[model samples]
Target: MSIRIPPASWAFRGFVLCFVFLSSFPGTILTQEVTLDSIRIFTTHDWFSIKPTVYFQCKGENKTVFPDVKNTNVSYSFKGEESWQPLTKLEGTKCKRCGIYEQDPLTHDTFDEWELCPSDFTAEGTYTHGREKEFNATFLCHGCSQVGPGSNKESGTEKEEERRGMRPAIVVLIVVLVLGVAAAGLVVGYKYWRKKKRQQEQARFLKLFEDGDEMEDELELQNTL
Candidate 1:
């Protein structure tokens, strides 16, 4: 004899089956969100200017793989700015590999070499001379889909320190220049004083010689008489 199942029991079973199927393939059932793991801002002190290099660390869902960074776009804005400005992708090698290879004793083959990966995206640009010192900046990747958590706040502090560092050097240069001018003036004044004293001595000696010559001429005339 076959047993009949209740309508409610059949519906519950069907719901359970659907739940199990979705749990087994969570990636398909759940939406994947792209996020930024971290961000770094590198400030380089160029002659009379500061260059800002922004690096972005993008991470996809565990089962999802990220595509080439060139396919994505990025932009940034200062703390008080109303709009976002595009960031130009920097060009060059962004990663490096350094490891030693060892031969397997039994297989007589080398092991897989390990490598170090860099940030997924990088952009280079210049900040206004004092703008970096004034406020923090934020970066967005993939057209504002991924954002950095105000990671560039340190940029302002670094810029202030850089400017502070220059102060001592400028002060030193000014001091040296003042000392040099004072030394030159002293040397010139000494030379002028010596020349004037020498001229006075020469004039006195000439006057004395003239007086003795006149006396000798007068004595000669007396002897002749």
Candidate 2:
């Protein structure tokens, strides 16, 4: 008994796997009543995400609280920065202090910038690009939508801030991309070259076989003479 795969079927199998890998990545959870924040305010390291989540519940007088999605003016500042820079001035939605999606075009990762979360308890986590290290993050909320807790709206004199240094996040991303492209190029190039070499070798062998038969015939004729 022999096990064999047809050429077309093998190619089809490889295509399916590549599609799945590129479509979605691990550690990414999409769920209801959950907000994932990936903040990129820190220029020190290129690709870092400050992920935090808040869950809310009804309180006081046993009243059921409806989601009063309010203006979450997201601002970013680094440690020891003079003032925070306003990234998104204001935003409204059917969410109370929910972590929303914000993207950075330079490094191409969702930035965590949304502010003020409502919850019975808050949770936050931090990890480097590609699971290098795990660390806990601390975040405080301001100007929360007070359906049952406090404050409805407020504003203050904003400060100015500047980003600094090569984000560790950016460096890691560039390195990974370069390695991936190099690997794919090598694999594809090798397959193409091997196929051409096999064809050329077969042609050379055929020509030598024909020459050998002709030489045998000439030697027989000379002997007969």
Candidate 3:
């Protein structure tokens, strides 16, 4: 048996995104968003491949991975969906190990270690601006959180992003349109049904009136005879 963090509610990972006006490149910093689309529970032969993916950030039109993602900035769900427990946060820990991202002062390319830790990752012990590293190999998301469509969250600026809380604008518009069309169809059907019902009632009242007149004539003739 293995000790693991049980499934957590849907989580929306976010962070600040600021660009230095790199002459030609432009970008906005409105809290980077990340969703745990899906997490498969299985075993792999490697160690880091089996470790948890702590933080998934968007940097300069790119999605990067940080395995040293301390337990802090991460939240967990012990019960069903929507419940969360935050992991322990780490301020500055040694990030010179495997999968730690850093920038080479000479090449400026993100690599792990010298022999083990590549040169691409931002060294935890080094790098003042915090270099974001991308782990190329895929790994198992231990204590993985399920992702929701996330269109119902209410949050303020700098507020944490909720899973499935705020949906993409285009997606939200499409959903609203579909629901509107369905509602209109129901209303039209109801109106037509009401009209048909009124016609049926009129026909029934006429039939009853005609039968009553025939009965009255028979009674009058019997009395005269």
Candidate 4:
């Protein structure tokens, strides 16, 4: 039979369990100092290009201006502009808070590696800082221009039209390899001058058949006397 809970309700239940365990730890709840809560502009177009991108959102911490309250913070115009362009703090942009290591099952050693450390902010391009927001600034669209082929003057005019389309296929493959080595040296100099004129016409027909068999052996030895 016990029922007594009251010392201002046990100090309001121990300040609501230490504000819900320090608001579930993440920089231990100190949010309520930054403002600029909305400003998105992300247009993109082609066919007379235009590509604007300016996102800046914030609400209670991630501050970059507007602390004592009195603001203009970041501005923009162009949709029938009336003058308000004032967003220029993008210098080396920054925002990195990553560190959560844990490996030590019996000295596999690697604990916290750098415990509870998160602070390195400088999002430049019209200053930005914390609060899961991106696209800081990138406006340069005046009658837009940036046609494709990764412009460098369209990649040097597509490498001078691929070297003027490979100089007429390298001058038609060096004029068909110099007319195929001048038609294989005129068919090997006309088959070596027709095999040296058929070996000088078979040595002049065997010297006219050995001068007609030496005049028939001197008329059969003068008819055997």
Candidate topping lDDT: 1
Tens-place lDDT per residue, model 2, 1-225, is: 956444455456555654554344311222122221222223222344532321122111121111221113322222321122121111221122223222233443322323332322223321122111221123332222222234232221211111122245446556765675566667667878998999999999999999999999999999999
The 10-residue segment of model 4 with minimum total lDDT is 109-118
**How accurate locally, in lDDT, is each candidate?**
0.36, 0.34, 0.32, 0.34
Which candidate would rank higher by TM-score, 1 or 4? 1
lDDT of 3 by residue, 1-225 (tens): 955322221111101111222111211222111122222222222234234443322222233443333332232222212112111111111111222233222322233322111121232211112223322322222211121223122223322332233346436555655665566566667868998999999999999999999999999999999
Residue 201 in candidate 2, Cα distance off native in Å:
2.1
Best by TM-score: 1
Cα lDDT of candidate 3 equals 0.32
| TM-score to true structure, per model | 0.32, 0.31, 0.27, 0.25
Total backbone collisions for each predicted model: 0, 13, 28, 7
Please give, for residues 1-225, the per-residue lDDT of candidate 4 as tens digits. Answer: 956333355445545755675464432354212113233322212223322222222222231321222112343323323222221121111112212111222222111111111122222212232222221222322211211112222233554575576567557656755675566566667767888888888877887788778878888879986
Those runs of model 1 whose alpha carbons end farther than 4 Å from true positions after fitting are 1-154
Report the C-alpha displacement of residue 81, candidate 3, in angstroms. 57
lDDT of 3 at 207: 92
- In the order shown, the candidates' Cα RMSDs to the true structure are 35.9, 19.2, 20.2, 35.3
Q: TM-score of the candidate numbered 2? A: 0.31
